[model samples]
Target: MAKRATVADVAALAKVSSATVSNVIGNRSGKVSTRTRQRVLEAISALNYTYNENAATLRSNKSNIIGLVIHDLSNPYYTELIAKINRQLAKKGYATILACSDENLESQQSYLHLMQRHNALAVLLCPTWDTSGEHLAAWHDLSPTITFLRPVGSHESDFIGIDNYQAAYDLTRQLIADGHRQLAFIGGSQSSRLRRQRLQGWKDAHEDAGISWNDAHILYCSSSMSAGSAAVMQLFQQTSDVTALVCYQDIVAFGAMNALHYMGKTVGGEIAVTGFDGLSDAEGWLPSLTTAEVQIAVLAEHIVDRLLARLEKPQEPPSVTLLHAHIHWRASSHGDVDSSHAR
Candidate 1:
């Protein structure tokens, strides 16, 4: 019989320490240079060595696993942010586990419970719309969590997100300036804090401009292209005067544009459209999209930094960090504003 391979054998073959080999094999996302990691992987393959993850967890008393919980996994902006965070955590010697809530409270509860069973080192959560202080307290018992986008409870807690209010306000104000009086605030979660903040901004902008907005124009839908398309159709059925659409995000904006095109309406000429989350796809839209850019890289750095800090000082008072948004004007907002305000 052939002798069984071991971590020591792989480490020696790779010209690295046994611990490094264990880190590579156990977590697959540990603090190692890309070259060194590849070398270790090759060595493991050559040796046919495998380590028991349960035994490793028992030995280390830490899982080296980070849980990422979010509402929608399909959004490009969120996906980009997750990729950056996954890379950053890998460099810090941690593996990531993702759980999508699909904005459902029950699903969020199930995923959080699963993370608890794994004894996750920490969690980065984009909270469900219905999350409350009581719910947060229950979750705190499971893992240290740093929330983003939607925050719950009055209790001090770690949170990092963009200024939803200001972003919406700025974009709506610009659309109003472009002679769009009847604007529809489209695509929002049922009752999310971020949604409320954004809706308030849109309303406040109308008031500031001395324009009255109809309550029926405020339409709520999931943050999805199909949902956005349906919402636009429904809104137009309700009223035809809505010349501008203040979409919740870029994906929704794309759907709105597609719907308008199907209706034989010339976008940017007769009707204007604007959205948040300056996703790359927005720029490639036929007429292009005007949006508020929330820097994902910056948000990831802040999120990871705060996560590490939380792990270090579990008892420290919680804090909130709101990142800035840069507005990019394009033909989607107005045909003339493209040259004047495009970024």
Candidate 2:
């Protein structure tokens, strides 16, 4: 059996230093002379050499693999986000290792550990509801991490996410302008920071409008269609005064819309419904959903650029970025006002 080709063999065959061979193979900027690169290429072609990424990672303690750990993959929001980030990473010559934590804190930690073992370049996380500052500290200790959507409690690292509070405020104010006096917030648990940010925005809107709000109006449930439908029944059971709903997710809004139909109630006319994460499906439904569009392409660009920049400039100070989501005021949230908000 023939021994496998290594960088050492390539360097020896090409009469160049091993570092020169590595620079040529890695396409290191302005490092390898063209003459030397040509020689290394010829030697590699002659030997049929294949660079071993795993071995290179072991030696340099750096990897071209990026980690994506999200709390829920069941939500289309996360699925689409994964797709966008994966595409962006692939374009930059990095591979993505995705893990769904199912919103479990323990599972999330386990995946972070797995990524650390693989020496992942960095981990982009949508933190679990119960994720704490200590968790962020420990994970940061292990690898470069950027938390998104729901920022971690601890000021452990950088974050890039939509401006949940502002977007919710804008949406809620719009609902108020449309004459929705009684509004309900549905989906997501109390433990989620992102949910709290959104809820605060909703509550502040009511306060600013001189309208009374209460805790009963905030429904805590899993971010799913079933939970959404159940939340509607649960809200009506408590009091049917809720004139509108502000869902934690678009999926939940979809469920609420379905539930409203089953209850023989008109969705937009009787009880306006609004959703977060302006998913593509939200735009094409029978009554197009009014939602805060997260703009996946823009978010993915931020995530990937942050990751690549971190790899190149590890010493730079970490920062948090928040971009406002575009509000699509469609027929679903059609209230008393003239529907000027585009579908």
Candidate 3:
């Protein structure tokens, strides 16, 4: 094996002190002659020397890296959001360390510990389904942490998420106006704060309209296309009177659409389906899904911005930002009036 060159070797060849070589490499010299710097560069090139990044980070107490914790990478929503976050963070001269929890609380906590070991300056978390204040507090004590898509309990940390409750409420209300009285909700664990908000909105809308809230219509499923499809099937098997379905996510809506197609039923004509998280595929679906368009890119940008700001100023008060979701109407629903007019 060949010996690796060090700064001392370059200094010995350049006839300069190691400090001079360090100054030249870091471009921090003010009094060193340009000729001296040039000679150090030439010696470095001859030695094929590389700076020790780990050693440098150890001295600086920073890794110049941020941690990103998401529930699942298989979902297109999180993947797209990560892409946006990566692009924006890279522009700020930072890198991301990604971790997937698979909606498992234990797995998420383990990843947080790993991130802390890596000296992550901050963490942007898409919390697990069972994110409690205790879990968030433990992570926050390790490093500056911010909640992205899903909020963790009510801990005072930066939170950036769409108004899931209002979005779901509006979608359900749209269905109600479309003559969909017997509605069903598909996907999402009721324990999750985000899911709870959406469910509350559904209940509020029905209650405001003087309609009875039916517990049997609410179906809990994982946020997946398969889950959505299964929920639709289960709903039909239990009660065939469901005229509209409100999915917690667009992927679930996609699954329900597939289930409807497999059952030889028309999506828009036979039953209306609305989804949250306006995924790109929603626009191209056969019936063009009606959904709440969550500004994912904007949300990612804001979350990164907040996280970086917190990293720069840790003592600052925590921020809570709620972005609104726009309801996009298409052929999936029966209403012809624009949402703006309904509002």
Taken over the whole model, the C-alpha lDDT of each candidate is 0.85, 0.87, 0.86
Could you tell me how far off, in angstroms, the CA of residue 137 lies in candidate 3 after the best superposition?
A: 2.8
Residue pairs in clash, model 2? none
Per-residue accuracy of model 2 over 169-232 as CA lDDT, tens digit each: 9999888888877889999887778888999999999899888887898898888899999998
lDDT of 2: 0.87
Hey, what RMSD does candidate 2 come out at? 3.5
Of candidates 2 and 1, the better by TM-score = 2
Best TM-score goes to which candidate?
2
Distance from true location, Cα of 192 in model 1, Å: 2.0
Query: Judged by lDDT, which candidate is best?
Result: 2
What's each prediction's TM-score? Answer: 0.82, 0.89, 0.87
Arranged by lDDT with the best first, the candidates are 2, 3, 1
Model 1 per-residue lDDT tens digits across residues 1-343: 9988888899899999998886776555756778999999999889888676666787777788999999888888889989999999999989999999988888987898888878788889997778876776777866788998778754556989889999999988888787777888998776777888889999999999888988999888877899888998888888877788999988888888888988887788767999898888888888999989987888899999999999998989889888889998888876543332232
lDDT of 3 by residue, 40-136 (tens): 9999999999998678789988887888899899989889989999899999878889999998999999998998888888888888878887888
Q: Which run of 10 residues does model 3 get worst, by summed lDDT?
A: 334-343
